[model samples]
Target chain A: MSVETRTDVPPGTAAPAEARRMLRTLARGTATPDRLRRVGAVLVVGCVVFALVSLFDGLARSGDVRDAGQRIAVVRADAAELYRSLADSDAMATSGYVAGGIEPADVRARYDADIASAADRIVHAAGLLPADDPAAEHIKTISQQLPVYNGLIETARVYNRQGLPLGQSYLDSGSKLMRSTILPAVDKLRMLENEALSRAYGEGIAFPFIVLVLGIAVLAGLVDVTLREQRRTNRTLNLGLAGAAVAMVLALLWWSVALLVGAAQISQASTHRTAATALDDARIQVLQARSNESLVLVARGGGSADSEFTKLLEKVLGPNDNGGLLADAQQAGVQVESIRSAAIGWREAHRKVREADDNGNFPEAVKLAVGPDPTGSGATFERLDAALGLALDTQRKAFDDNAGAASAALAGLMAGPTVLALIAAGAVIGGVARRVGEYR
Target chain B: MNTVNARRPFVYLCIAGVLALGSAVITGLTPPPAPPSTATQEAPPPAPAAGCEQQKVDSLRPEGPLPPPGQMPPGSTMDTILKRDRLIAGVDQGKYRLGFRNPTNGELEGSDIDVVKMIAQAIFGDPNKVQYVVLNIADRAQAAADGRVDVVVNSFTVTCERQKLVEFSTAYVAAAQKILVPTASGVTDVKQLAGQRVCTSRGSTTEVVLRKPEYNLDVVTYPNLPDCVLDLQRGRVAAVSSDDIILAGLAAQDPQTRVVGGALDEARYAVGMNKSQPDLVRFVNAVLEKGRDDGSLLASNQKWMGQQLQVVPRPAEAAYRD
Candidate 1:
């Protein structure tokens, strides 16, 4: 009655102006029942969306974390065992051949066991990986070649027992096949597994930015609604709006705590597990290289054998001009200087053995090549491998401790987020519905 | 009354559902991981040429009586050997009993080694003064041609191509190329081995014969005879074919294996010397003649080959070209 009439100077426009003023009033009063209900519906839906998004995100990330942890602990361990078994088999075969007369029964048994272990590991590891995985192809190659290598070794053994020098050639063929084909494939499989692990680990700790922004936006909108209510109704607080704001804030806080804890754990695991794997790789390479060296002498391939062992040694340790696995370990924070020094000693001892053999002092050469004397090249190689073994043990322990903690930290995180998300969504719906009720 | 309009909220719910579904698909349908480096399998090396069928191997005839020990004629290769106080003979240390070192004694003792020692004794009267230089099957002739050794006695098969490079002594042992197979491989002869892999030493007569157009057999060549035996054991090859003497040695080693097929070619074993060393060739021929007259040659063959070979004392009849 008042505002439109107070404008009393315009009599003919009174009807239209009154209508206009009513429209303005309706527009200004956002607490009207229809508008309140609409706003409450939107807020409730927003909370539901946010809850679902956060829950699924947490669950997916936790899955990645769990997968990576399991692979590092189990799959990588199987691969490492395969590597060791192949190298050990090669060494035993060479030593048995070099034993001269009849191969000792224990040495023969050990060779067979090592071969069996390698085959078992290949089959087990292949079963775990998908068909399309690159490691699977490598596994198939090793599986196919293993029997051929074993057959060659058996032939060498038979010929050796017969005192035929052709046995050495057979042994050479077996060793060459192992060094050039099967072991390299295993090495490649191990590398692919490590790469997969790192990828999964990387994905596990990524932050959920969209979830955080949406949560904050919802909280701001709730606060604005509460303040507007206070201004219009002279109320100190709207319990519904206040409850919604608290729920949004609590949801965000819980998300933050879980993310921070998971991030720390993943970070620790990544650092220690990657370093440990690198050290193990280096150790395995050293073992294979040492086997190559022994086999060259066992095969007595002469100049060609010498050069072949040199190439293999360079691949494992380093060339005199550059660095290889030892260099890689050093870069990864492992103390491998002792291993390097021991390898150098091995090379020197091998040179002396070569010199004796070339000088036609074959007995002296055999004594220097495989003798149990501390100064023999074989002894030096043993010392080198032992040092690498120690290094590997240290790294392995560190990896186990850190990765275990990482897995434990992610424990229950997936389900915890889902539960929190559900409670937050329920609370938001309830709070917004109460405001709609007040409007009614 | 306020209208209960649910259209806007419904639209928002639809958008949320679509976004959620999109993300799930995105996460679930990731492309497969790439394979690691693909290893290239090792390719086999090039094989030697297969000689023509008409090619004949002509060896020297070792005729004449050996002079008394240390009583060589003046200006002869034997005199040269006597002055040097050592006979450098190229030998094989990988052939089973034909030319292999004794494992227990670490001494080079084989039929070939025995023949060379007798020659050394005829010149110096001491077998210990001989120096053995190990040579492979293909390099034996080259070693003699290059004068890197005085003689190559490592199972040299007298062939036309080899005779062109070096002079051959009379064939000391007659070996025929034969097939060795697993006991129950269902392959009794070379005819049954068509389209199947047969292993032999590289650059040997057996590999050459197997590669001929008529056989159409797949031939796998190895660096040494033992490797062929290994391939046969693994069933990678259906059979291993080489000189009968070599097959006999291999069969003796593996009880499950036997010499199955008949002779494929006649491989004559002879010692090789450089073409420029005529006096040395003549002296070696003389030594062979004297060894055949005495019982020492038969003894040498028996001592190493008694188990696998019933070696007949049929010294190669000598014929001179000049």
Candidate 2:
């Protein structure tokens, strides 16, 4: 120590080796200012690294939540809307076929709107999905098959107007195509979009473990170094090191609180997503039941249309009409009572439709099934569908609000880590420089 | 200081773990939807072999001229129908020119429909009093047995087997099974189209005849005659075989097709009634007696099918089982 160990480097020695020797010399001294300065330098470098890592990671996470809230949710809804419109279009077409004189203007207009909306949604949804996503293939299949289905419906309409039974045949083939091809594709696309939305949610709130670890380690190092210096100098506190420790503590605390809140919001949003899909599924079943009912009359009770109605009815109301899809939807926190009651009423009306047909009162059956009776199967099903639509809207709004809050909670998280870490680095340098200057 | 706040991070982590676990548990409560089944049901096994030997069976006889409209005999089926004020007639709406609903006006008009109107006119005095119920060809006998309809005028063919479940009136119209083909195909004979796909209405006598191994042809059956015509038009089948009248109506709608081939089997079209309702059968026969004598049934056949088919319709002469 008296010889001033490693204070001067030997001539021709490399700078790095000289520096290493100096660090070793500083380590050998107990309660020395040089060692305190070395510890402070390490803490400053740790703070710099932590700052860079958290800054980029925080920004990326914020972006993920924004994309999930805005982009993924929209695409998911578009896929759902596409499925509904296609099914509704077929129902309208079948209804028009049964009403058969000249096509009813309202039915025809509704069909046209459904087709137009379906096409529009397909285009919009395709644009939003990533080019390499598996969802793209399903979108392609639906777009290709839709026009073919429409052509068949048009041909059927012409024949129906002319009172040709072949028109019904054409209509049957069209519906077959829709069920076999287009609907299945839309179903797949919807599933894929939902998966993407969930992935975004998971990524948005994932913990930044490395940054927090580095932050805690730097704070501990600074505190340990400052305490030794205080004891060595017989002083109570070092202002510079104390300031750096405080900055580290505040940044870590803010990050933890913000992420926790954001995670809660994102999780709630996911719940809404679950509820919405349930409602969407119930709505689809309603449309299909309507289609099957009308086609039975249009085909004049041929084929398996009657049995198909039974199967579809069971799908919604369960085997006994007490619980099924509506029950499942209820478990998802959606209000299904309205849909359930309307469905029960619709079931009763459908029973009368079948009875009249069985009793050889075909005109009476037609009147009960499709006539302007306010309590008929058609009107009751319409009410059920409306209720489902309303429930879906509520869930959608809930999802949007929660998702937006999730994004908002991430505020300042990106800048906080970087700014606080820079402040810590400055304090560490200032505190160590003061001691080293006194020794000089 | 190290011990004082060291457990704070652990506490926060515990809270976070609990929250995440709760969410996962909640999500797991909903079982994911099962994938839709892709399998289609197989068609029902071919109908049971004819239960009885085939034979020509004359329908019930007309005991007297039909009671005057609005003056039905007490305790008769007609009287009950008059009390209800509407004759519920089960008919096929798909058989064009026979019992089809006219799309232009939504009115049921055809030869078979004409028979129903006559019966209603006889009982209720107003032809408009009849309420039409469109039935599948397979349901005609069961509908009668159950008393679900007052009468069936769906171009029904009489056979000994049907007599077990239903009673029939004197034939108001006569028909024979024939094959229809696209005019462009130039295939005139059923034998020439052997080994080719042939279409017919499901459960019809023609379906039975086409499946006979000797024909050596593939057969496809739809719910109605027009459906077969569509298959033929789409080239999915080489020909459609059905009653000549129904085939004639289909050919009339699409001029590119024509009815050909000889009559494979002949059947008499009569008003089908419940076996228990012998009085109803007699009443329907009385009404048919008027149509045959007055040539009104022939006039209807001519008016509905004359342009489509050149052959003049021959109504069966009145015969009596009792």
Candidate 3:
């Protein structure tokens, strides 16, 4: 038996030069015991390590997404609360003042409570916020300017009680401060939080394709080596290599399925949660509109009602039916259709009041404005506000349900894969070592 | 010894794992407490005592119709005023169209100050002969108590509490409390202002009603009426509550506001005098009687408040308390 191998080819054999060179390379191929074992070890270890890295990287990013989503939800809620508080305080302040010169006890208490809540929420938001976040500046502005506005209001109160002509001007200044500075700052903070939330969701479902490629490569290598070993030894199977190959395929399948589930969850969250959040913006606009309505009456034709209030109403309800914030919310499938109609009605009532005032029916205008009549602007505004609030609640619930599920789906996934990866690596080493022992 | 050494790595690994788990659990169970914040708020000042009642009193019995100007009753307060060469009268310069100085021209012209001029005319026969002393709401009572001015006629609202502090002449002008709000303000009555900011002048009867627990209003008081009107115009306070006539003056100044709702309280304006000066009180009452009877009161009302008020001229009926 002359060791029928290419490396042992006779020197006189009439072989082409290319054929000889190819045979020499084949003789030095990885089929040799040491090379096969070494190559198999590398493939198995490489696959496990690559999968582990990909798993951990994906896991870290998913964790970040989950944390950011939760934080964004909290911060966004606080921001909205602050915005509502400021707006409600403004409306209540105006209503109270219109009702009387000195604020009624109930109205004053409500205003004070609103201010306190706004301050507290700002503090909480500031704490959760990044050091360099733009929202931090807005929060600072609210904090700093809130006290100033309150002081202006108190000054107005004192002056109003004294029956001084200057008190009305002070009250106007206070309202201006709220509209121009504080509310806008709060809106900016809300927008920033919203952006951060979207970024986190985008990062969470980012797929890691490298792990799949590495897994496939490792499996192919194991299959090829096993088939080669079977042919050379005339054996039907190598149990150890078969085991390693099976483990690699299983890991690949698990990673692929897990990624698909995560992606599906992320997609659902993006569509539903983001849309719901957009509705929140519209809901806030409704609140702002309500405040403006009250202040319009408070202004007593001081120009704010005609200019600023008109602009705000158009912004909230969409001008000429061409899609404002509420329209956008409707297109997004948020439950704001009724609110939209109510807002229109409120605006119409307001216009009627203005016309009455212009026509010199001052008493009639006042009655239309704040009267308890079902068709009055006050009642219509309350309805519109309530409808929008309900819509916001519904959207918030959907966001919490969907995003929360997505985030929860990722929990324990990281830890499970980490432990599995270590076991897989150990198995690859053990299985390959068993095969190498056959040569001994 | 070899067996024991072989198990050492496993034992050490187990120990490390347990320690790690134990420490994590311990740390998780005991979080660091948050630091206390240093922010605090100052306590508000205590509120003033309440329960002052609005009171009505009878006019003193005048000797008769007033004598001609410059011919005063000898050994009386009128003689003392004649000797002084000018009627020393206390007036408010801040009241709009009532006692306020005109910003356009340096002249004191208003309903209350007009009454002061009438008194001066009665004493020295010249309306410009009055030496004017400006008095605030608080100063009105003290001025009368200390005899700083001949009489305080600056929208003085009579109350049982203030009567204890200073004597008042017979009620000259009976003003009533009412609400003044912007045209757009839906508040039509004081009852509607239950939770509203209701501004009134300090030491005014409107303040008493606004501060009552039943009304539950945010009663903001200022030293003078102009400050309250300023607050209303600025949208700082909701509505102003004071004497209807005073509010009408405010409404007249600013077309944006109107006096709405009925009277919350009655304010009977009287000339404030020293408790010891009964003759002065009687003499001022006589002047008021002449003014009320001779249409001068109606004339002053027409001059300053006619456009703003629903004027129905009538004499203030005289009553004798003694």
Which candidate number would show the highest TM-score if scored against the true structure?
1
Q: Point out the worst 10-residue segment of candidate 1 chain A by lDDT.
A: A296-305
Clashes of each: 2, 0, 45
* C-alpha positional error of residue A381 in candidate 2 after TM-score superposition, expressed in Å: 7.9
lDDT by residue (A171-244, candidate 2, tens digit) is 77899899879998998888877887887778778676655666676676667666766876777688888898
- Model 1, A348-437: lDDT tens digits are 887888777554455677678667879898789778878877887777677666666666665655665456555655665665566567
- Global CA lDDT computed for model 1: 0.72
- TM-score: the better of candidates 1 and 2: 1
DockQ values, each candidate = 0.19, 0.16, 0.03
**Residue runs of model 1 more than 4 Å from their true location after superposition:** A1-31, A104-159, A162-181, A207-268, A271-274, B1-33, B36-94, B101-109, B115-152, B163-171, B181-197, B214-216, B231-239, B255-263, B272-295, B311-322
Ranking by DockQ: 1, 2, 3
Instruction: Report model 1's TM-score to 2 decimal places.
Output: 0.79
TM-score of candidate 3 relative to the true fold: 0.54
- In model 3, how many backbone clashes occur? 45
Most lDDT-accurate candidate? 2
**Lowest summed-lDDT stretch of 10 residues in model 2 chain A?**
A1-10
| Model 2 misplacement above 4 A | A1-64, A97-99, A131-134, A172-248, A267-398, A411-440, B1-52, B159-165, B168-172, B191-196, B264-268, B317-319
